[model samples]
Target: MREPHRTDSATATRDTRPVPCRPADARRTVRHAVAERCRDRALTCAGQALDDALLVTSELTTNAILHGGGITGFDVAVDSGGVRVSVSDRSDDVPVATARPDEPDRCAAGGRGWPIVCRLARDVRVACLPCGGKCITAVVPLR
Candidate 1:
């Protein structure tokens, strides 16, 4: 997981629902749905940025399973600028996006998730709930 990106709060609204992405398969499906629903909602912002949004969702969900202890639930929201995806897990460790310069090969895996999310999302945020959990969110812009 990575640190949530930043964007002005004045232009976006929160739209979230419960989803299960603890399992690898479920996470994949959720990622797909983030793009699908975003497009279906007629949120024009999603059309051009769906791929980045999907990638961001995938990373967040994957982090939830690996670091957050497990994906208890998740949600998706969209605004004029782009789509917002949120994943809630059991842990409170805030994810920080870091740049790894050692890996010259851009195709390498393992440490790119957070960096990717930060790059793709217009804004990313993480909030800790009182009940031992946290929600990581990302907003991807349209074309």
Candidate 2:
């Protein structure tokens, strides 16, 4: 006679809760998410995609710290297609328009983080939070 196997949904499910991280700490959180999510899966170009993900993570959090009065919330979700990163902060100003590179006078005050983020992310979105801030979501494709 064989004993029956047990399945634990609570233990198996990944916690989908929002993780509050400092600007510098978000990257590590992403790295861990990527590693855990990619453990069994295989992607031929994961290296470059991972780099892009990390860069995007750095830019969002750094921008929050520098311009948005620090990060309020952060979350990362890794799937077979890509990694989705959401960074929330305390600001209402638009990231791209406010710091458009074509306008040298205003652009010179900021670094290249926004442009880099826009270029690397497959899909990017920004939404105003009801609590008086904004959230930026960027999805970097793994393929």
Candidate 3:
């Protein structure tokens, strides 16, 4: 099993304080937190659901870093319902799913992650923070 990276907090599930600078860090944080907190719950146990959650995590964090200026806050919480991953960045503009790669106008390298996130996450929300930027929360139900 992978050990959760500790920062100001003593454990992974409790260490929601770090603002991940990279997508991998955010994904790791989500993985550890969700795995630790939701292991006993049948619907929250690890499997394809966990993989979907990680993919959503990657997309959100990568988008934040690439388009939202930078990640200002990151957090994850696990419950009987599912794992909720929230990522806040400096862009007030909301995320939009663009055209597919095969589309004539869409950029080939990008525009795919957002749709993947939308598809995998059961509930997706984008809220503009009062301070600045926006926070995207995605809940991926484990099965």
State which candidate has the highest TM-score.
3
lDDT of 1 by residue, 7-61 (tens): 3545444444346644445445545555564455655543446667677778888
TM agreement with the true structure for every prediction = 0.68, 0.76, 0.81
Q: How well is each residue in 12-114 modelled by candidate 3, as lDDT tens digits?
A: 2443557889999988888788767654443446779888889999999999999999998888877655677888899998988765658886556788888
lDDT of each: 0.68, 0.75, 0.78
Least well predicted 10-residue stretch by lDDT in candidate 3? 1-10
Between prediction 1 and prediction 3, which has the larger TM-score?
3
Best by lDDT: 3
When sorted by TM-score, best at the front, the candidate numbers are 3, 2, 1
Worst 10 residues of 1 by lDDT: 1-10
Off by over 4 Å in 2: 1-21, 42-45, 97-109
What lDDT tens digits, residue by residue, belong to model 2 across residues 28-140? 77877777666645444358898999999999998998999888878777775577788888888879634455675763656689999999999888888877888898889
